[model samples]
Target: MNLGIIGQAAGLYAVTNIDDILVLALFFAQGAGHKNSTRNIALGQFLGFAAILAVAVAAAYGATFLPGSAVPYLGLLPLALGTKAAVQAWRHRGDAEEEKQAGEGGPKPLEVAAVTFANGGDNIGVYVPVFATAGIGGMSAYVIVFLALLAVWIAAGRYFATRPVIAKALSRWGHILLPLVLIGIGVLILIEGGAFGL
Candidate 1:
């Protein structure tokens, strides 16, 4: 229960998690000008982050059982999701209003959670080593810090959703951009992890 270590862990998480702000902003922006629920986004983020923590903990304990190569393949989850969105976007390219309306139901909480978890491949990469070293108490502190910061993360994203300029652009182009971003993130994860030796 060292406050200093928790603060340090929180800072480390803040630094490493900057990109998540963009992903979350995009998620929050998904139903721009529609009835999107911030609750879903926040809850999905928590679930996703919780999943990442579980993976890191599992990796810490089961490092011998899982092959190093297997980690990167986790990228496929987001890749598949992004590709689906991209194809749907292409199919309805001419029907801009309909496309927006289709998204009005907003991304499902599970969908958001999956994307968030899949995109966290890098976080797992970093967390595994930390968990290996942190021991149980320190790990618990880090987990608490991570959960605390998630609130800030969601707040920032919701704020971004409120901005007129950002909101408008997301409203106009989010359908196209969201999928590409997700796919790019997946590819980057695979590349970074050296999955398939690519």
Candidate 2:
């Protein structure tokens, strides 16, 4: 395991994923008053990121077998998800608290995971190339570091949620911001990947 490579991969992932902080803060805020909410968020995030890694690694190995043209179309997953979110947000524009209270009824673990996965279209794009060149040992190191950083990310989100000011702000604006972020991510993926020839 190369310490430098691990650190580099971890840093790259962390730095490039600043939007995750806001999304996580939203999750933490939504999970308020629920005992296992944090656990659910952490687990969902892990599942989502693990899925990204799996897809990336698979793409790397399947290069010879899979048609490269088909890969970019994966952007559709996030594009559709984001459009749904935006519509939901727009419908609830006048009732933020009501929408939140409704959502607070349960821990939407799968929802979070799905959004995380969809929002990670860019991560998939970035990771595929990186993992392609990494040998088995380097891949293992990257995985280790990524999992470790995931924990820190969860902790940071939870911590931020505990702060009254931050939590309040997130609760008030997260619904609006999340949809935009998701849509932007989706569009960026489509444009960059040139899905369907743009």
For this target, which candidate reaches the highest TM-score against the unseen true structure? 1
User: Per-residue CA lDDT of candidate 2, range 48-136, in tens?
Assistant: 88887788888777643336565556556656766776676677667658665574453356766776776675677677777778877
Clashing pairs in 2: none
Instruction: Check candidate 1 and list the clashing pairs.
Output: none
What's the TM-score of each model vs. the native?
A: 0.89, 0.78
What are the RMSD figures for all models against the true structure?
2.1, 3.1
| Residue-by-residue lDDT tens digits, candidate 1, 32-133 | 545556888888889999998898888877654346678788788788888988887787778867565574567778888888888876788788888878
Q: What total of clashing residue pairs does each candidate reach? A: 0, 0
Candidate lDDT scores, in order, read 0.82, 0.73
